[model samples]
Target: GRRALVAGVADDNGFGFAIAKALAAAGASVCVATWPPALNIFLNLIERGKIDDSRRLADGSLMTFERIYPLDATFDTLADAPEEIRTNKRYAERGDFSIEGLATQLVADFGEKPLDIVVHSLANGPEVKKPLLEVSRHGYLAAVSASAYSMVSMVQRLGPLLRPGGSFSSLTYMASERVIPGYGGGMSSAKAALESDTRTLAFEAGRKFGARVNVISAGPYASRAASAIGI
Candidate 1:
């Protein structure tokens, strides 16, 4: 069976969870990576069987993740992580949660060319409540860093590990091009960057690694990320 890694799955209410379940239902062995801070909470939810009902597929089989790793897409490598982040209680015990670290860990656990699909379903904007004009430089860059450039970093780090012709996908929003009130904190700009980068990555990754890169701009959905935008 093909192996797939779906990153950014912090809860059951988002596209990440749905994608992971769909991949599993399609006969792929799915694995997921959650943010370090929410890793334990997510695991607890799973351990307590809180999402078992949601995990059930149309055919009655329950979705299962082959493995769950801790990941923080903000850093491409562990060395890029700040001391405070490295020492945080939630991250301290977790070995290398950076994108590169995840790639290395995947290689160690599953051998070379271990993945057939890589899904980037995560985004974050700390100053989402602030208007774009009011968003600070730090906040704007952080939004682009976590929400947009992370996909580039992921492909750079994980692309080589994908089997030939493997698929790499990320989620975007209409706010990238259309003006959506309350979608602030440079998130719209980030999504725009994500969409642009996807097109460029499609050509680059396809040639270099025989992989396909794509993005999906989903309509409004009451996921946690959307709710953060006052949806």
Candidate 2:
């Protein structure tokens, strides 16, 4: 069976959750990575059966993730993570959550060339409600780091572990090209960068690893994260 890893699934409402169920239906063993602070909440929702209905597959079987790991994409390595983040209750015992850490852990658990699919269904913008002109430099850079550059980091770390012809994809938005009021804090810029990188990465990763990279510029949907933008 093919194996897939979906990063940034925190709730049943998002594209990552849907991608996991779809992969399971296609007979793939699926794993997911959730932001550390949201990991406990997401697990509790599952354990309490709050998302049971969302787990149903097309074949009537309930989709189950083979594993769920803590991930904080802002940092590429444990060494890059600040001491405060390393010691946070949600993170302290979660083991390494960086992209490099994830790649190493996956290789250790499943051996080399273990993954057939990788999905980057992640986005975060701290000052999304503020206008772009009003967003702080800190907020803008943080948005780009978490929402855009993380994909590049992921591919850099995980590309070698992907089987030949493996696929990598990330979600983008129309706001990447067109202005969408209230979608501020450099999120639009982030999505634009994600799309631009997709083109270059497709060529680079394809040539180097025999893998493909793509992005989906999806229409707006009121997911938990999107709602914060008042969309």
Candidate 3:
């Protein structure tokens, strides 16, 4: 049986959850990696029955998922993280859900097994509302780090955990190719970089690991993360 790991789910309303559900419906054991800070809220919503898991899809099929994991990609390992980032107010609240933490948990539970599929559905832009000219270096880097480079980082860290011929997919936006005025800050540039890196990763990872990498340019949808950018 195939196993899938989905990254970047904030809630059931997001694409990550939908993708996870779809994979589960297809009989794949699906695991999700939610943003660490929002993992509790996601669990609460599921526990409180706020989102219906039995809802029908367009094809009249029911939705389901296996597990959800906490993930924060800013730090690959707890030891590699600086004290300030570790002690930051928002980060401190999530406990140890960093990339290394999840990797450790996955290995502990699955015993060094290789995953069949990996989905990159995470993105963020702290200063998305600000114009590019007014965006600060920190905000620009944050956008690139969260939205674009995270995919590269994930492939670097998790690629070894994927079986040969495994498939990796990421969700991109049209903003990479066209301008959307309100989509300011360095987000557009970030998307462009993401698309470019996707191609590079596809070639490199495919050759080295015998895995395929691709990206989807999804149509605009009002997702929780997108709403934060007022898109």
Candidate 4:
């Protein structure tokens, strides 16, 4: 089964959305894992038929989802979340919706191995507007954890959920290679680690799980988090 679970589609205009559309056009059943805060808005947009026309397949059919699940890559497991976040109104209905929770849910719904493609499109630079020298320790580290390690965490948890010959991918940026002004905090460092880990994970996951791991360093586009850069 060509079933894909794309994590991090905050909106219809992002790269994640494009990847989902392409997979659907190729006859793959698509499901998305969205950040909880954006999840409600995204579903509302779909319910309102806002992007129905744009979801058309090459064969003149509309691409649809198997289901959309709530996911927060920041917390690897439900137990990893803080008490405040656990009881927050936004997270109440998400149901232990972290990386590990998602893995368990997948198994419960689809079985031991159900995925053909797993895409990690998550990136959060909370202090993107601040200069590197002025960034707080917590903010800088948070950026790395959210933007880089989240991918690693996903691979570790989702590897067993992917079938042999399956693919695991994450989105990165050119900032990993060169110092881009206005892109400060630890965002660049995070992307660099993400690229580095991608190579290492390829070897580990390929050898252990028969899966291919890769990173796509796409250029800048106006995704939801773009405005936060204050560029």
lDDT of each: 0.94, 0.92, 0.81, 0.88
Q: Show pairs that collide, candidate 3.
A: none
Choose the strongest candidate by lDDT: 1
RMSD (Cα, Å) of model 4: 1.2
In candidate 2, what are the lDDT values of residues 1-231, reduced to their tens digit? 899999989999888998898899889999999999999999999999999899987677788889898899999999999999999999998999999899989999899988999999998999888889999999999999999999999999999999978999999988889888878999999999999999999999999889899999887777889777665
Better candidate by TM-score, 2 or 3 = 2
User: For model 2, how big is the CA root-mean-square deviation?
Assistant: 0.9
Could you give candidate 3's per-residue lDDT for residues 97-156 as a string of tens digits? Answer: 777677677777786864889999998888989989899999999889888888887887
lDDT tens readout by residue for model 4, 86-194: 8988888789789999999999989999898999888888888787888889988999998999988989999989888899999988888997888878898899999
Candidate 1 achieves a global lDDT of: 0.94
Off by over 4 Å in 3: 53-64, 88-95
lDDT at 201, model 3: 97
Report the CA-based lDDT of candidate 4 relative to the real structure. Answer: 0.88
Better of 2 and 3 by lDDT: 2
How well is each residue in 1-231 modelled by candidate 1, as lDDT tens digits?
Answer: 899999999889999999999898889999999999999999999999999999999999789889899999999999999999999999999999999999999999999989999999999999988889899999999999999999999999999999977999999989899898788999999999999999999999999999999999987778888887667
Tell me the spans in candidate 2 whose CA falls farther than 4 Å from its real position: none
- C-alpha lDDT of residue 10 in model 4: 65
TM-score of every prediction relative to native: 0.98, 0.98, 0.90, 0.96
